[model samples]
Each structure stands twice: as C-alpha cells, then as structure tokens.
Target: MFDVCIIGGGIAGLMLAHCLPSSLSIAVLTKEDSFSSNTALAQGGIAASIGPGDHPTSHATDTLFASAGHADAERVKLLTTEGLAIIESLLSRGLPFDANQAGLPLLGREAAHSTKRILHAGGDQTGKMFLQYFLAVTDDHVKRLPYNSVLELVLRDGQCVGVCVEDGQGNRSIIQDHHIVLATGGIGQLYSQTSNSSVATGDGLSLAFHAGAVLEDLEFVQFHPTVLTLNGKSHGLISEAVRGEGAWLVNADGQRIMTGVHPLMELAPRDIVARAIEWHWQQKGPVFLDARKIQQFKSKFPSIFTNCHNLHINPGQDLIPVRPGAHFHMGGVQTDEWGATTVPRLYAIGEVASTGVHGANRLASNSLLEGLVFAKRLASKLLSIGFNFKEKEIHLAEVTKEFALPANLQVRMTKLVGILREVDKLQKFNTDFPLRWFDLQHYSSLHIKDIHRYTACSLIAKAALLRDESRGAHYRRDTPETSEQWTGKTVELSLAGYTFGERLLKYKESMS
Candidate 1:
C-alpha cells in the first residue's frame, strides 16, 4: 500500500509528487517511457501573467472568452491567479525562461491572448525543460513506474482505492493507495491525425469514466490550426506563437485563408483559425503558413525551423503545408478547485480532468500552466488532509462488464469526428461503436491500450452528439449557432447514457 498513486508521470504527476511531503510514499505510473507524457512533447510554452502590460484579470478574461461560456469563473480565476507563483516556483527549481537583454522574461503572444505573455525556455523547449526539472526533483523519492498502463480504477462504494494495471510483459498487478491522481494527457491519438504523441490515448479519461466519475465537455477537442501535414496526416505542430510572430496562413494560390474570418486574423483563437484553415483546405486543396515576413524566423522558432528543414522546406522560401489536427482536449473527468472529482479519493489533473477552465476551447499555451497550477492545488489539499501509509480494507471482487466499442472504431472515429461534426454521423457511430467494443473485448490478442482507446472514443462521440450547439472547439454543421440554454452548463456522460441540467440532477439521485 502507498499514500498516493499518480497515473501518468508527466509534469503534473512529477510536480504533485514534489509538492507532497517527502515522508509520504508516492508511486508515479507511466504508460510508456517516463518522458513520453505530452509535457515533454509540448512545443509552445506555458502561459502566465508576469510579463509587462499583463495581469491575471486580463488573462482570465481571455481564457473565459475563448472557452465560449463553458469555463468555470471561479476556477479560471484561481488558475490565472496562481500561475505567477507557480512559474516562480518552477524558476527557482532551475527552469530557465528565455529573457530579453533587460533580464526580464521574454514573452510571446499566442492565438487568444490579450498580450504577449507565453513564456518559453530555450525557445520551444519550455515543456521539456520543466519536465526535466520536476523529474530531477521527484526521481529520488517517488517510485516511478514506466510501461505500466492502468486498465481499471479500483473503486468500492464511492471512493477509489487503487488501480488495476498491466505492464508490457503482460504481467498484471493491483496497486492499492489511499489517493490516486490521474495526470494522463489528452486523447489525441484516438484520431489518426494529431499533434499529441502515441501515449495520449485518453487512458486517464477512460479510467475515470469506467469508475463512475462524471465526464464533462468531452466534445470540445481542440484542433490546432497549423500542424505540418505530410501525406494526408499530421506531423509536427507549428506553434500558434509562429503566427504571433507574424506568420500568415496562405493557400495554394497564395491567398490568405483567414483574411476576413475574424479581427485577429492569423492570431485568432484556435477554433476560429482551425475552422478557417479546414474550410480552405477542403475548398482550395491545401493550406500553408508563409513565415517569410517574420524576421529572424529560424532563430525565434528554431524547433519549427528544424522540423521544416528536416522536411526540406524553408519557411523563408517555401510555403509549409498545414492542416488542422487534434492538439488539445478541453474536456475530461470533471474536477473542482482542489482537482477533486465527484468521486472520493480519485483526483484528476492536467488534460485528463475538466476543471472547466478551458470551457469549449482552451486558450493557447494554457495547458502547461493548468497542469502546474492544479497539481499544486491538489498537493496542498492532500497535505492538509495529512498522509499515512495504512492499507484500507477493500472487500470488492472483480466484476467484468460488457465493453461497448467496435474493433475498427478508431478508424471510424477519425473519419467522423474531425473539425466539422454532423449529428447523423455522431449518432450512427455512437450506435455501432459499442457493439464492436464488446466483440473486441473477448479477443485475447487485443491489447489494453486498444480497449482504453475505444472506450475514450466512445465517450467523446456520445458527448459530441449530446451537445447540439456549436461553441468553441465543438462545431457541428447541424447546430451551427450557439444557444443561451447550454451556457454555463455541461454534458454529464455515463454508462446510463448522457444527461444535462435537471436530467443530470435526477440521474445522480437515481445513482444514489
């Protein structure tokens, strides 16, 4: 037994371990190599308000505006307010943010921000740097387990006691703890094309959902406007900061794609920009980002430059082919200010939890900050409760239920659930997916990763179908306009089906 078991050894897990008292026994579990979490792969930067001409109030405003009325006002305030202190903490731990000649942190603007406040270290290595810093701090004390993916959450009555995990060698084990924190990243890999790494298969979301945690806003999948598209699929991401540096999205005919779409044009919120690019990509064949105007283009974004160079395309001369690809999840298991879910002893942080700070759309570069801020909040909350390594008596027996997803559903999901969604497709896919999931469940050849991917995809599809209005990252052609009724409300998903507003209230009462 342990005091805490943290799934996903990313920045959130590492930082949470760092904040917890060293006397407590914490186990950090990873699905792959310890560094495979999206934290290390993040290329943009962490968003905060320490730069000149910026404040958390304005930061909060931009975030809420981008969320399109789904972000929790209180949580948004907390996330923005706590950002500066956490950045300072990370700085004290040796995260070297790139600074200007005046010795102030150099801040770069992204899509929805009101000002240039996204901070990077070593140019595009902000996430990588922070990951290394936290890993170094937590490596000695925390038991880091890689290649062990959590298959199920161990819940008895209402509290989560532990997790059932299977390693790459097919060895299965049960890990018992008083608390479990899920920091597993986004569900980007559910799509054939995405900016996220392979490990981002929504394992945490599935784990939480199967264990009876409420999932909110699962439809709000953020497709970034500018990802390098190679051979009809997504490649490396071209950070929104590239456009903030004055890059323009152009088509094959050299026509700017987003000229009249929004006031901010290329620097508009990712949802607007991604839709415009996708619309143009379909109408005019392909889209590209022309970065010739940005002075010191290679130096300002060396990572993007290197990726382009590797593909034999120079931003100064050639138009890099770009397309919208799944980049971030603005929804997951619902959590509160302390990152505690509706379920007891099971907390979620990072992209895996819907703290409702992102609403329908996530503001650019806010993801890294969300993980850092929420993990700190959770750590503080857990510390206040005190820690003890006593095993709780769990009398529950394993029960197998029907898995409701199709065998080849991942391909179907990628086809139907892209930037533009339709109710017919969503409904049809939702109906057929579960039957397939059941079939695949009995196959001994099927891996645990595949099962989790199907489950997560099913939840996303259900949530997308449940919401009939277009807002933020969730755009449906049938429901092209946002409605006032859905504002400040969320889609609550479970095995009993989807619920909303009063229906959600009744559903919980029934569960009780």
Candidate 2:
C-alpha cells in the first residue's frame, strides 16, 4: 500500500508530492501523460500581492468584487495575504519571472485589480513555467502511474481507502493508499467550446460526488470572454493578459464592446466581459479584439502572436474575432481550509475543490495561485495529522447497470447549459435527463466514463436550476440581476440530493 495516491499529475498534485515527507510512498496517477492539465494551457499570469505599491487588503478587496457577492471575505483575505509566499517560493525555485532592470518582477494589470499585481514568466507562459518547474522537482521522488484513469474511490466503513484505476489496455486494478488527493482540473470539457484541455473531464468532481462528498456551487461556470474561434468552435484561448496590455473589444460593426458594461470597460472582470461579448454576439455578429494600439504586441505576447499568425490574422492590423467559451468552473467538491472533504481521508485541491477563494467567479489569474497554495496546505495538514490506517476489507462490487454514453450528450449539454442559462431550459433538462439517463445506464455498453459524465452534468443542472439569480459567471437571462438573499451562500450537492450548506463548516461537522 502506498502512503498517498494523488489522482492528478498537474501543478497541485505534483506540488503536494514535493512537500510530502520523504518516508511516505507517493503515487501520482493520471489518465493522460503527466503535465497535461488546465495548468499547461493557462496563459495568463498568476495573481499575487507581491508587486510594487500593492497590498494584500487591496488584492483581497478586488477578489471580493470580482466574486459578485458569493466570495468568502475572510478566505479571500487569507488567499491574498498568503499569496506573497507563493511568489517568494517561485522565485526561490529559480522561476524566471519577467523582471525589470532593477531586478524586480515586472507586474501586469488585470481586471478587477486596483494594482499591477500579476507576474508572468517567459512572457505569457506563467502556468506552463510553474508546471515545468514543479513537475521536474517532484517526479524524481514520486511514483507516477501515467495513462491510468481512476474510475472509482474505494470506500470501506467510512474512510476512502484507495481508488480503482483502469489501465490504457482496458485492464483494471486497485491501489490502496492511506490518503487520496484529487487535484484533477476543471469541468470545462463538459461543453463543446471550452478552454480546458481534453483531459479535464470532471473526473474528480464526479468521483467525489458519488463517494458521498459535498459538492458546492457547480453552477458557477466561468465563461472566458475571448477564446479564439476556429471554424465556429473554440480552438484555443487568447489570454486575458493581452487585454491587460491595452487591447480592447469591438464588434463586427466596429462598435467597441464593454463601453457601458462596467466602469473598467475592456478590463472588466471575466464574467462581466463574457456576458457582454455573448450578448453582443447573440444580438449582432462576431466580436473581435483590437490589439492594434498596443506597442510591440508580438514580442510581449509571443504565444498569442504565434496563434494569430497561424490563423492568418495580424494583431497589428486585423481585428481578432473572439467569443465566449467555457473556461473554468468556480465550484466543485467543497473543501475546508485544510483541503479535507466531507469524506474521511479524501482531500481535493486545484480546480476540483471549492476552497472559497473564488466563489461565484474566479478573479483573473487567481486559479494557479489557489491551486499552489492549497496543495502545500494539504500536504502540511496531512503531515501534521500523521496517517493511522486501519485497513478495512473492501469488496469489488458487481456492476449491473451498463449503458454507453450517447455521442450527443456533450452537444446537448453545450446547447442547454452553455454560457447563458435560463429556467425554461434548465427545468426541461432536469426533468427529462434522469429518465433518459436511467435507460442509458442499464445498456450493455455502459462504461465508467459515461457514469462520470452523467453525474457531473446532472449535478451542474440541479445546482443551476435551484439558483434563480444571475451572479458572477452563472448568468441567467430570465433573472438578470444578482440576488441579495443568496449572498455568502453555497448550494451543495450530495448523494442524497442538493441543498443549502454553510461554507466551510467545521471539519468534524463536515464528516457528520
């Protein structure tokens, strides 16, 4: 038995492995090759309060503002305050953050932030740099099981003892461990047009939900404002950092977008910007990014420059056609400050865990910071509370229900539950899905992946249907205003059903 089995090879899981005690046997598992994650594709820099003339209070305030009334003030404050260490740690690890001649990291301004507090490495490849640095350091020590998909979390008595993994060759096996950390990335792959990597299929979210963990705010899906449109589908992301460098949004009719959407205009938070772009696209035609005015844009944003060059669009002259696409989920398996879930010995970090840092919507570039900080916190917490495993007997349960996931399942979800949602469509899907899904589950070709898709989609639909107000990333055309009653609240999904729960209840209370 391994000491810990980490079910992701992304930044969060790998970072945790580096912090783990040397005596412990660590196994890092992933369905794809190691380093395939949202982290690899995250072009925008990570946000921290470690720049010139910046304070944690100011950063925290901006996070709260971007959250649109759903962020936990105390948690945001903590995240920003603790973010100082994240930058420091990166620097200590020899991360080559872009710096000025004075030897200070050059900070860029992002949406909702009052100060220039975003740090980039190798220009716009901040997340990729972080992943490369950490993965290199951690892989040497940890046992990595690449291309093994975790199908189920094995439960005995009340604690999560291990996971059931399906190999690439269609073989299955069980690996028992004392602790399990799910750093599995976002749920963006649930939609057709998304910024997430194909590997991000909500495996962690669905598995945790089925294993009786509390999942909160699955409805708050963040649609990024400016994804590159390749033949009407989202081919890639145009990092928000580009807008930070003075690019503006405009429509087909040469109308500037975000003029009246908010005071910050083009620099408005992702949710506001995405809503504006989507609304304009629905009403008018395609929206484009006007980066012509920015000085030396290609050198500064080489990645986006290459992307635009390949697409035959010149940022210097031509308007880059952009659209809203599924980018991030602000909610998932709810975890407390220590990254512990409602279930025993099961912890979730990264995008899979709703740690109350990003409530209704994530602040710009905070995703990487959240995952890094929480991964270290989880490792520390586990070390403090040493493992005491009284291994219980686990049985391989028989699979009765069997059905193949329909090819059109993703298409239906993308249509009905895309960026903009409404009660009429949500209600219809909620009512019709269960009966149809029930039949699909009992078919001969039912697979574990199909169950995961059904579970993730169902939970998101249920949560979105219950929340009748428009807030942050979860916008509803029917109720276009944020609700005051749902302030500082989170809708939790459990095996029993969905209901309201206080955010970050005591650790003992969570298991109760």
Candidate 3:
C-alpha cells in the first residue's frame, strides 16, 4: 500500500510527487504515456508575477477583472501571491526559461492581462521543456505506472480507499492506498472539436461524481477563440500569445472585424473573442487570424511558426483559418483552499479541481500557475497531517456484465449541447431522448461506472439548459445579453448536504 495514489500523471500530479517527502510512497497512474496530457500540449507560457514591474496584487486584480466579478477574491489572491515562489522552485529544478541579454526574465504577453507576466521556456515549447525536467528528476519513491486506466474509485464506508485500474492488456486490479488525488484534467474530448488530448474524456469528473464527490462549474467550459480549422475540425491551437505579439483577427472579406465589436478588440478577454469569432463565422463562411504584421518575430516563436509551416499555411503570407474550440473548464470537483474535496481522505488539483481560482473564466496562462501553486499547497497539507493505512477484509461491489450507448442518444447529446445552445433545442433533446432508467441503474454499480459518462454529459446539458443567461464561455443564443444576478457558478454534487458523509444529498446548487 502507498500513502497517495494520484490519478492522471499531468503536471500537477508529477509536481506533487516531486514536492512531497521521499518517505511517502506515491504512485502516479497515467492512462497512457506520461506526456499524454493537456499540460504537455500547452503552447503558451505559465503566468507568474515575475516581471520587474509585476506583483501578486496586480496579477490578482487582472485575474479578477478578467473573470468579470465571478472570481473568489481570496482564492485568486492566494494563487497569485504563491505563484512567484512556485516559479522560483521550478527554475531551481532546472526548468529552462527564456531570458534577455541582461539575464532578466523575458516576459511574454497574453490576452486579459495588463502586464507582460507570462514566463516561458523555449518559445512556445514551455510545456515540453517543463515535462522533460520533471521526468528527469523523478526518483524511485515516485512510481509512475503508464498505460493504466482507473476503472472505478474504491470506496469503503463512504471514504475513498483506493481505485480499481485496468492495465494495458485489460487486466483489472485494485490499488489499495490511503489517500487519493484526482488531477485527471478537463472534459473537452466529449465534444467533436476541442484542444484537449484524447484521454481528456471527463474521466476524472465522472469518476469523482460517481464516488460521491461534488462537481462545480460544469456549465463554464472555456472555448479558445483561435484554433486552426484543419480538415473540417479544429485541432492546432493558434496561441493567445500571437495576439499579444500584434496579430489581428480578420474575416474572409479582409475586414478587421474586432475593431467595432468590443472595446478591447484583439486584447479582449477570451469569451468575447470566442463569441466574436462565432458571430463572424455565422455571418461569413470562415474566420482567420492575420499574422502578416508580425512576420519579423517568427524566429522568436519558432514552434508556432514551424507548426503553421507544417500545415502549409505560413503565418507571414496566409490567413490562418481559425474557429473556437473547447479549451478549459472553470468548473470541476469542488475543493476547499487546501484542495480537499467533500471526501475526507481525497483531494483534487490542476484542471480537475474547482479551487475557485479560475472562477467563471480562467486567465490565459493562470492554468499552469494554479497547477504549480496548488500542488505545493496540497503536498504541504498532506505532509503536515500524516496518514496511516489498515488492511481489512472487504467485499467488492457487484460489477455489471455489459455497457453500451445507443447511437441516437450520442447524436442527440452532441447536437443539443455541442458548441451553441438553445432552450428549445435542449427541451426537445430531453423530451425526445430521455436517459433510460436502466442506464441510471447500471451506472451506480461498481462494474458499470463507465456508464456514468453519459450521466455527466446529461448533467452538463441540463445545467446549461437551466442557466438562461450568456456569461463567459457558457453562451446562449436565445439569451444573448448577460444577466446581472446569474453571473456566478453553477455547482452539481453527487450527494447532498455539503459534506461527503451526507451521501443522500447529491443535487445542484448555484451561487452568485
């Protein structure tokens, strides 16, 4: 038995494993290879208060302003305040960062920030460089098990004990551990087009909900505005840093549409930009980003330049075909300041946990900062309160023998809750294709927990339907304007009453 079993070997899990004391046995379970994570695919840099003119307060204010009054003030403050230290720690561990000739940290700008506070390494390849450094330092105390998918979360007497994971060859076994951490990232792959990796199938969110953990902000899915439309699907992300580097958004008609759309124009927040692009796409056939002005900076951003070259669309000459795609989740498993969920011995970090830092929308590079800060905080908290394990005889829950989704149901879900949403369409979806009682019954069983994937998707649809007003990434075509009171979070729980012990209370709670 180990002290901690971290599901999803992303930056958060790897960083937590590296930060914790060596005496504590930690096992990191990755569904595939270690590099298969949204963290590894992050093209932009991690935001930190590292610039000469930058400070935690300024960073915090910018984040809150970007979040548009939905952010938890205290949590946002804490994340920004602790971000500098985390950056320093990563630097000390040999994570290479870009620097000027004078040896000062080179800061890159991104949307929704008043200052140039993004600290990057190797241009747009910061994520790869950081992952490499993390892998290089991992010791024997940190056991990384790749090709392992967690089938079910093992709970005993309403407390999380371990997980039942499936191996590469489909062999299933229980990993009995005292503590469990879910850093399984976002639920983007559920859509037809998204920036998330294939493994990001809302596995962690669905697993946690089934195991009786509260999920928050299921409605606030952030869609990046500028993903390159490749082969009828948006795949490659045109980094927000491009806009920071003086790129412009232009429609197929060769008009810079953003000038009259929003006050901030290209520098506007992501939600505005995404909606603008969507509106443009609806009006015109296609949308594109004009990067011709910044051709001279191609050498500085070689990764982006090279990626565009691979697509046979040079940023200097061609108009980069772009569209909005699901990028981040502001809502996730509800957690306290210490990253502790409703469950007693369980915790969540990174994209999976709704730590209230991201609020209605996440600032461009705050994701990486949130991961680093919270990982350290969770490690410290876990180390302070040491845990002990007791091996006791327990019976496994009966596993269901079969599971499948009707093809029609999949099509309906994708249509109603895809990119755009409307009340009439949602009502039609629920009325026409209601989730069968048998599906819900099978989903509750240990062997059939994967069936809960549909349940999770249904929850998002239902929650999106309930939320009438357009705010942040959750836009409603029917309700075009933003509502004043409906400007906060939409929370969903597996069981009710604010505590994990209150298992029967799983319901929806919205706070403004």
Candidate 4:
C-alpha cells in the first residue's frame, strides 16, 4: 500500500510527485515509458506572465475571451495569478527557460494573446525540456511502475480506495491507497486524426466517470486549425505561433481569405481560426499556411521546417497543406480550484480535470500552464491531508468485476465521435452500436473496459447534437451560427439520474 497512487506519468503526475513531501510513498502507474506523453510532444511554449509588458491580468483576459463565455472567472483568476510562481518553481527545480540578450525572460506569441508572454525552452521543444528536468529531479520517494495500465479504480464504501493496474504480462494487481490522482491526458486518439499522443485515450476521464465522478465539458473539444494533412492522415501541427510570426492563412488559389471572415484575420482566437479554415475547405478544396514570405521563417521555426522537409514539402517555397484536427479537450472530469473532484479521496489534475479555466476553447499554450499550476495546488491539498500507508482489507474480485467496457465498442466509438461530427452520423452511430449498460456489471478485461471510449464518444455526439448552435469546437454544420445562449458548457454522463441535456442546463444555471 502507498500513500498516493497517481494513474499517469505525464507532466502533471510527475510535477505532483515532485512537489509532494519526500516522506510520503507515491507510486505512479504509467502505461508506457514515463517520457512518452502529450506533454512531451507539446511543441508550443507555456503561456504565463514572465516577460516585460506582460501581466497575468492580460493573460486572464485572453483566456476568458478565447473560452467564448463559458470560462470560470474565479478559476481563470486563480490560474493566471499563480502562473508566474509556477514557472519560478519549475525553474528553481532545474527546468530552463530561454532567455533574451538583456538577461530578461524571452516570450513567444500565439494566436489569441495580446502580448508575447509564452515562456519556451530550446525554441519549440519546451515540453520536452520540462519533462527532461522533471524526470531528472524525481527522487527515490517517487516509485515509477512503467508499462502498468490502470484497469479500474478500487472503491470501498463509496470512497476511492486505490486502483487496479495490469502489467505487461497481462497480470492484474491492486495498489490500495488512501488517495488517488488521475492525470492521464486527453482523448484525441479517439478521433481519426489528432495532435495528441497514442496514449491519450481518455482513460482517466473514463475511469473517473465509471467510478461515479461527474464529467463536464465533454463536448467542448478544441480543433486546432493548422495540422499538416499528409497521406490520408493529419499528423503534424503547425503551431499557432506561426501566425504570431506573420504567416498568413491562404486557400487553394493562394488567396488570403481570413481577412473577409474575422477582422483579426490569422491572429483571431483558435475557434475562429479553425472554423474559418473548415469553412474555407468547404468553399474551396484545401486550406494552407503561407510561410514563405516571412523572413527567417524556416530558421525561427526549425522544428516545423525540418518536419516539413521530412514530408518533402518545403514551407519556404510551397504552401503547407493544413486541416483542422482534434487538438485539445476543454471539458473533462469536473474539479474544483484545488483539483478535487466530487468524489472523496480522489483528485484530478492537468487535462484530465475540467477546472473551469478553459471553458469552451483553451487559449493557445494555456494547457501547459494549467497543468503546472493545478498540479502544485493538488500537491499542496494532498500534503495538508497528510499521508496514510496502512494496508486495508479490499474485495479485489468484486472491485475489478464492476469495471467493464467492451472492445468492439471502442472501434465503434472512434468511428462515430471523431473530429468531424454531425447529427445524422451520431444518431446512426448510437443506433448501430448502443452503449453496453448491462455488461458493466461483470469483471471486464482491458478489451472490455475500452468500450468506455464508446460511452465517452456517445456523450460527445449527444451533447453536440443537443446544442443547436455552433460555438467553439462543438460545431454543427446544420446550425452554423453562434447563439447568445449557446455559449455555455455541454455536459454528459452515464448515470441514470441525469439526462445529458438536463446536466448541461444545470451547469449553465449554476454558472449564471
């Protein structure tokens, strides 16, 4: 038995472990190598008020504006206020941020921000640098169980007791603990194309929902505007910072089209940019980013330049093919300011927890900042609660039995609720492959537990269908206009007490 069992090994989980008291026994269960995560693949920098002419208030304003009316004011204030200190704490722990010639902090600009306040490292590889420092500093107090995938959350008397994880050899074991934190990343892999890593299968959110935690904002997925479209799959992401550096969004005829759409043009917020690109795609054939005209474009964005070269497409001479891809999820397992869910003895942080900071759409580069700030908050909360490592009697067979999701359901989920969602396709998806409410009673294998992907996808589809207007990433081609009242969040759950639409209305009313 350990004091805390973290279900993921991403930056949030790692930073949480790093911030905790060394006396506590913390065990981290990672599905793959600790280094492999969406955090590690993050090319853009962390948004914070670290440079001159930048302040958390401006950052807060940018975040709130980008969220499109669904952002939690209190949470946004807290996160933005704590942003600088979070960066300082990471830096003190040996994480390096690139500095300018005047010995001041260097900053980069993304699409939504009013100021260039994003702190980066080694140019575009900020996430990689952050992870490298985190892994290096983590001491023996933190135990890593790599290749262990959490199969179920162990619950006793309506409280989270621990987690049951499966090893590489297919052996399952329960690590009973007084507290558990689920930091598993986003669910982008559920879509046909995304910028998220393969491990981002919505495991943490799915486990939390199945374990009776309320999930919010499942419908508010963020579709990034500039993913490199290649060989029937959109893989590479041309960072929003490209526009910040003067790159223009152009169409098939090499025409600058965004000027006719939004006044901000390429510098408009992510949702606007993505929708504009999608609309342009419908009007023309393909949308691309013209980076050739910018001086030192290839030198400044070396990573993107090299990646484009690998694909045999030179951004300096040719237009880089781009499309909208599922990039981030603003909605997740609902959490308070301290990253505590409604469930006692359970906590969530990073992208897994919907802390109300990123409501409908996440501001560019704010995700990394959110993870850093909230992980620290959660660590402080856990430390205050004190650690308890005494082993408790648990009904292993029964606990494991209650968790189940079928395999076929997973494939069906990916098909139905992917990047481009529509009402007819969603209804057909539900009719063809209904959610397995009955099969959840028995002890399920990994293949079976994966069907929660269907549960999650179904929720996203239903919520998307329910919202009659397009707002942020929850776009409906049928109802293409953004409505005044539709600016709030859309929530869904598997529990019978609340219908999906009712839950959304309740959340909206609560916010009001």
Best candidate (score: TM-score): 2
TM-score of each: 0.89, 0.90, 0.88, 0.87
1 or 2, which is superior by lDDT? 2
Task: Return the clash pairs for model 3, or none.
Answer: 494-506, 495-505, 495-506, 496-505, 496-506
By lDDT, the better pick of 2 and 4 is: 2
After TM-score superposition, what is the CA distance of residue 380 in candidate 1 from its true location, in Å? Answer: 2.2
Candidate 1 runs further than 4 Å off: 244-248, 251-268, 290-296, 387-408, 435-446, 501-512
Q: Candidate 1, residues 1-512: lDDT per residue as tens digits? A: 87889998887888899888878888989989977878888866889988867778888888888888778777787788898788876666567888879767888877668898889987777788887777766745689888887877877677788887777897666789889999998988898668888889998877777777788889999887788998876777997778877888888788888888999889776678888988886677888998888889888788788899999898999998998888899989888789998788899999998887888888888988999899999998988876554565654344444433455565687667778889998988888765122322222323545667878988899888888999888999999999988876788886556677321211111110
lDDT of each residue in 189-223, candidate 2, tens digit only? 88777888988788888789878898998999988
Better of 2 and 3 by lDDT: 2
lDDT by candidate, in order shown? 0.80, 0.81, 0.76, 0.77
Every model's Cα RMSD, please?
A: 5.1, 4.2, 5.1, 4.2
TM-score computed on alpha carbons, candidate 1: 0.89
Poorest lDDT segment (10 consecutive residues) of candidate 3: 499-508
Evaluation by TM-score, superior candidate among 1 and 4: 1
lDDT of 4 by residue, 111-223 (tens): 67898888888777888988888888889999999999887787777888888778888877778987999999898777765777888888787688777887777778887
lDDT of 3: 0.76
lDDT of 1 at 330: 93
